[model samples]
Target: MNIWTFDQEKDLNTTGAGLIAALLQSKPKAVLGLATGSSPVGIYNELIDMYRRGLVSFANASSFNLDEYVGLPVDHSESYRSFMNEKLFKHVDIKLENTHVPDGNAPDPDAECAHYEQLVNDHGPVDIQLLGIGHNGHIGFNEPGANLTGGTHVVDLKEETLKANARFFPSFDDVPKQAMTMGVASILKAKQILLVARGEDKAEIIRTALRGPITTECPASLLQCHPNVIVLLDRGAGRFM
Candidate 1:
């Protein structure tokens, strides 16, 4: 695991975007595993700026989002698909068909999971996978547990997760009770993993996930088993380090 601490927010965003831009530059057809939520918004914005300035191009790249809320419509404001399009994809020149976000509204979630896994197998190993850690140390929607799933699957969102996401909805009850997320094994398949975190709220979990024991109890800790992982943190989030 390689850890980076930045004093300013722009530096953190630029660092993450730079790594991705470098990947796209070296391999125009590189596949990117992306994440949604507040942590990655800044990085996505930076990449959009890079695209506008001609500093980088995503014309030939492909992307897959890590997770999506189960039962949400693709057009829903909070859906991962919408989040990606609004934050990054629409700004770049990448083909819309080349980007994939799991269908959260699929009638048979099990089937959707299998189909998504097969898709990953077809276009993977992902060149780089981006991630954001939850306050409870979850990655994607893989909450802390005794045994973790190893393939794409539907999961009951933990209370902490639901509460954390409440801010995105008008009320706590509006937050989805379930989610479809890539498994730890699926994520580790990536050739490279980039984990981004910011703010003091994430400090303890960041430290635990990075320096603490590698166990299923902290899902993000599983990244320690991967050969290549990069951790980018703003100073507030790196406080415990």
Candidate 2:
């Protein structure tokens, strides 16, 4: 695990975007595992700029997003699918057919989870897996628990998790109580992992996730199990470290 702290937000985003650009340049067909959240929005913007500059092209690349809200339609503005399309994919040259987001509305989400895991196994060991930590140390909506799932699956959102995400919806009542997320075992299969975080609000959890005990209670701490993990943090987020 390699950790880095940056003073400027742009520097952090540019550095992350550069890493992804380098991977795409070396392997045009690189499989990218993506995440959505305020933490990654800047990085995605930097990638969009790289695409416009012709410094990077995702033409042959494939992408799998980290998670999605269970009840949100694909077209919903807050859906991970919509977030990706609006934030990065629509502005880049990537083939839409190659991008995959878990079908939140599938009749049987457990089946969808099984199918998603299979799809990832067939096309992945993602070359680069990007992640963002939750206030409760969740990753991909894999909330804290006594036990954690090992493949893509559905999760009943924790009360805190629901409250955290309610900001994106019109009201607390509008927030979905469930989500579909890549599991800890699934995320560890990535060839490389890029974990990003910002703001003082994330400080304590960041310290616990990256430097404390590896446990199911702090799913992000499980990143310690991966052989290759790069963490990018802003001053506030890395304050404890």
Give the Å shift of residue 55 in candidate 1: 1.8
Highest lDDT model number: 2
Report the C-alpha lDDT of model 1 over 40-84, residue by residue, as the tens digit. 999999999999999898989889989999998899999999999
Spell out the clash pairs found in candidate 2. none
lDDT of each: 0.94, 0.96
Q: After superposition, how far is residue 223 of candidate 1 from its true place, in Å?
A: 0.9
What candidate 1 gets wrong by more than 4 Å, as runs, is none
159 in model 1: Cα distance from truth in Å? 0.4
lDDT tens digits, residues 6-109, model 2? 99999999999999999999999999999998999999999999999999999999999989889788899999999999999999999999999999999999
Each candidate structure's count of clashing pairs:
0, 0
User: Cα RMSD to native, each candidate?
Assistant: 0.7, 0.6
